[model samples]
Target: MSVKFRPLADRVLVEPIKAETKTASGIIIPDTAKEKPQEGTVVAVGPGKKDEPTTVQVGDKVLYGKYSGSELKLDGKDYLIVKESDLLGILG
Candidate 1:
């Protein structure tokens, strides 16, 4: 709600949405055992660059590659500002 990002052109400032749960070895993971969320809220989005343009929006839920992009910490929380091409897909 109070997100401020000065993303470079053609890039998006995202707080990857974190999943609340995890499962492994055919067992459910407890909250304590669950891994840190790889996904998070979309903090800020940059203006699309290039002629064709990117379709991602500021509030759109998106999926990015596991090892994609750089990581940054804001207000003690982690965030990523990757290129629009880095986003894997938008959540429906």
Candidate 2:
């Protein structure tokens, strides 16, 4: 998972996790009805601001706001560049 792009100044590069396409009852969800996923894997992280180093690392699964980051596409893969503050929490 090597990326040519690197975030700067507290920004994080995240690869969004796709929303569930099927319900627990085996009902299939339509693409248009699917909600944007708030969970993602951290692909790249920027150095923290002065006196504060970034806590999240690459490959960390995290939760963020539904509309937190700017959308990006590289090599046909969707990504998000959000501020560290936009991230809600780290996922196990």
Candidate 3:
């Protein structure tokens, strides 16, 4: 509970949980385009924004829009930086 994210206002820098090896469409997406993918592992989390505080935590797996967030790489791993509003919902 002591951990925190460097969120800029309502924007949350999130790292989405990784996707399955095979996509839901049953297609294997190549690596290059996958760099800016919606799938990733949640490593860090931001505190929250005004009004609508972030309901997500560091370990929650979430599904975002196709062109949802800003993609980043940490330790050669891909991550997504999305606004708290961009998050659709927490996946079960």
Clashes of 1: 6
**Candidate 3 lDDT (Cα, 0 to 1):** 0.64
For residues 1-92, could you state the per-residue lDDT of candidate 2 as single tens digits? 99899899899999999899999999999999999999999999999899989999999999999989899999999999999999999999
Give the range of the ten consecutive residues with the poorest summed lDDT in model 3.
1-10
lDDT of 1 by residue, 1-92 (tens): 66656776778778866655645556667777755544545667666676756677777887887777788987777788788887878887
Off by over 4 Å in 3: 1-5, 16-41
lDDT of 3 by residue, 1-92 (tens): 22244656555556655545667889887766464446444455666655666677766767678898777666655567887678777777
- Candidate 1 vs candidate 3: the TM-score winner is 1
Q: Model 1 — TM-score against the truth?
A: 0.71
lDDT of each: 0.72, 0.96, 0.64
Off by over 4 Å in 2: none
User: Which is superior by TM-score, 1 or 2?
Assistant: 2
